[model samples]
Target: MTKIVPKILEDPFGNLTIENVLEDIVLGSSPYQVTNPHPYKPISMPRGCGFHGNQTKILIMMYSGPGNINQRRHVRQTWRELKDPNVRLVFLLGLLEDAQYVLEDESDQYGDIVQEDFCESHGNKSTKMVMGYNWAVTHCPAADVILILDETLHVVSDIVFEYIRDLVTESPTRLFRNDIRPDQHTGNSYVNLISFDVAKQFHILFPYIKPKDENLNDYVRTVANILSIKHIYDPYLDHENPASFFAFTGQNVSKHLLTYPLNINFRRLVGRKVLYNEDIPHQPINENLPPNIHRPTRCKLLRKGAVQDQFLVVVWSDAFDSEQRSTIREAWGYPNITVKIVFVVGFLDNHQNKIDAESTTYGDILQVSAKTNKFHDTLKTVATFTWIAQNCENTKFVLFLDGNINVNTSMTMTLMKELVKSNDRKVFLGQVNNELEPDRNAKSLTYVSENDYPFDRVPPRMLGLNYILSFDLIKTFDISFPFVKYCSAVDIYIGIVASKLMLTLRNDERFDRTSHSSFLRGIP
Candidate 1:
């Protein structure tokens, strides 16, 4: 069972408290400083700053509407609590047409207040508010950080200020406001922060913001892509209660820092069993058999009386030491099975040594260029099989096996027998689990079903660790799928194509159910 652990941190804004009447009216909690001193102190600059020279200015743009006394009070109260030397708070009011009379008296009540006259129009207040802030930001060149706050938000000024400060300092680039809900197309409590350089780059890349009729989400997504900004969505901060703190900095930091929830209880329950220590013991082989044994005939053979020529085994070698290769060779070094190993080597300079070692072990090697191996494509590697199969016509059966897999001699024989026994002429074989247990924990073997299968399934699955294909099938595949220039994992590409072509896929219970190593049991 997977268990989730909660991370605990000191509440950054635990000190702010409001009267019951005020609390009942407000939707979100206010921000308060946890421990840090005021960030900046006042000067001729727009906002006061506590720390000179090094101080960062925070500009909060509060939007208000006429007759929104509660929202205005909330904004004023929030600003009062945020009265630090480094922060500046500005309130902007959007008045409906013919309601300009209401703002005349309130302008004197609030200092540093700006009003926009909207007459004979039913404009969206939210859009106007955003435009006002954009204007202020453009005009106020000195402002370093900007926080666009909705009037209804009750926040602890100190906590939010510090959280923003920490984010600006820690993030490789500025953080953007991102919506928490996946379904929401727009309007979530997320912000994007970019460095000055990135901001300039964005301006150059995307010159204009879309009009009101256009989708804002599309515009933002374009900007985000241009800037390569990472989005953080915090569900906890989108709430309207005291637990809202859990929604803010607390939730943000927790989600970002802890990719996986710590399973403390499960860790204690599993204990030292987490670290597995079993090593696979090497098995010796019997070299008494004929030098070139014919294909086994115990099972239903695809081509009746098909004379034995050469065994064609496909080796999916990643990397292996000489000893490991020798051990595998001895176990599988039968006269009937001629091994043709395919090496999928990536170009990353760091992995060059591993590639070199495998090349030394396997004589038949396919070198895939790393420049084209981007985005998990292995089709290019698999395409090389066409040339191998065409060149080696005497090869009867093609065996695909991962280089690192430990296959016993008996297991190989059993797999080969099953493949030969399969009745379908265009058959692809793999192992399947018997039980309905999670794929991660299932141990039993089962036969793969030949139901409605699609051919064009990329990286064909169920075909198990190794797939056996007859020479005829290979010839047909090469001819039918001429454009096999794959840039993805071969298994997936093969599966997808097989499914599209309605290929007959068979699962061998004996090979699928067998566990060669104990290490697989603990695989997460």
Candidate 2:
């Protein structure tokens, strides 16, 4: 029979010098038992059976801290749940030098319940090794497995222990619910259960860890190294339970099981209700019909000579800061174009400043405030389209642009030519980019499908940045003006209006110049 030699080192104050005790255990000629005893447990595993009915001894390690009533209650419950008759549960508590005076009295209460260990130093290293040594000497002779437990962590039910027992029986591996990675932003944290083999291996690689060290996420990494243990992270285990075990374990394993739904308790507790209201019917703005007006064949908007010289460009400038207005002015610096820029200033307090008309050579600036009260910003955008119809007569087309947009002069010209070539008189022109591949269509136009309007797509075109619109469509919008009020967002409102009006929107890939790189690369 191999003789078991126990070597103990106790330091309650040191971060974690438990590796020293592990070194002693592995180096010793004989088998060893390890234990830690303190009033408060850090974090640990449940006590249970090993592979092939082998007897496993458990050491409950603790550092001194205020006793938690909840944890104690759970611990008592866990004790009742353990079914294995062969497992021995040993508790080791570390005592300070001052506590030694009354140690005899303290020992009397717990000595019968758990094996008591004492260390002189307050550092964690001394405390950990001393307890480990005590367990080795007292239990190593017959122990085939070792269980470590922290005081704060409690077994919710006996099922937890049985689950771990089954895990060990099936594999000679470490089990944990923690994952740590260099790419991850959050550092080491506890996970439910991990195996000793991996823990021991981790200890070899990271024998001594400082809490403040950037690489030192959790203390368990060191132990996992020393044990040479293969590990499996079970998401269903509840050693850490509601709180994540990965938090302390620093194991970056993907959770396979969906044991619990996220944020259920809070959602149930809040009891918030969502109410649905009936949508009001939209009415046309322009009642008058053109005698010569005819709906184009194939529902296409663009036909030659459809777009005219005089047009209204509705630029949605929710908050026209000086920088944005300046960019708009610089981009639209054409002199010969008969286009007037209509600025829709949403959420307006006062028109304190206006876009400089003299600087904008291509068009004149028209500000239409939504005056939507608390919801003023949204209303102003709606008002912009309406205002364009009521005010801009003889305007053949309407072009919408966002204030921050910078137009590629050549691309804009090319887009205008396409709009002219596809002069259907009822269709809207929009820009398309190759980068937005998901939205692209075979027609080289991007459109979203609508169930109700099988013939007409919802949000007809990918409407953003700059687009040219027919003046007749603007007139049609004038009739629909009163029915629609302030919408939540401007773009969606335009989409809804375009959808209902049956406006044929066309895509002009040439004008697709909006990009993040353009902004990031600087305004060259």
Per-residue lDDT for 396-456 in model 2, tens only? 6666666665555445555555555655466566652112112323353333222212221
Q: Evaluated with lDDT, which candidate comes out highest? A: 1
How does candidate 1 fare on TM-score?
0.35
TM-score of each: 0.35, 0.32
Residue 186 local lDDT, model 2: 59
User: What is candidate 2's TM-score against the reference?
Assistant: 0.32
Native-to-model Cα distance after best TM-score fit, residue 32 in candidate 1, in Å: 46
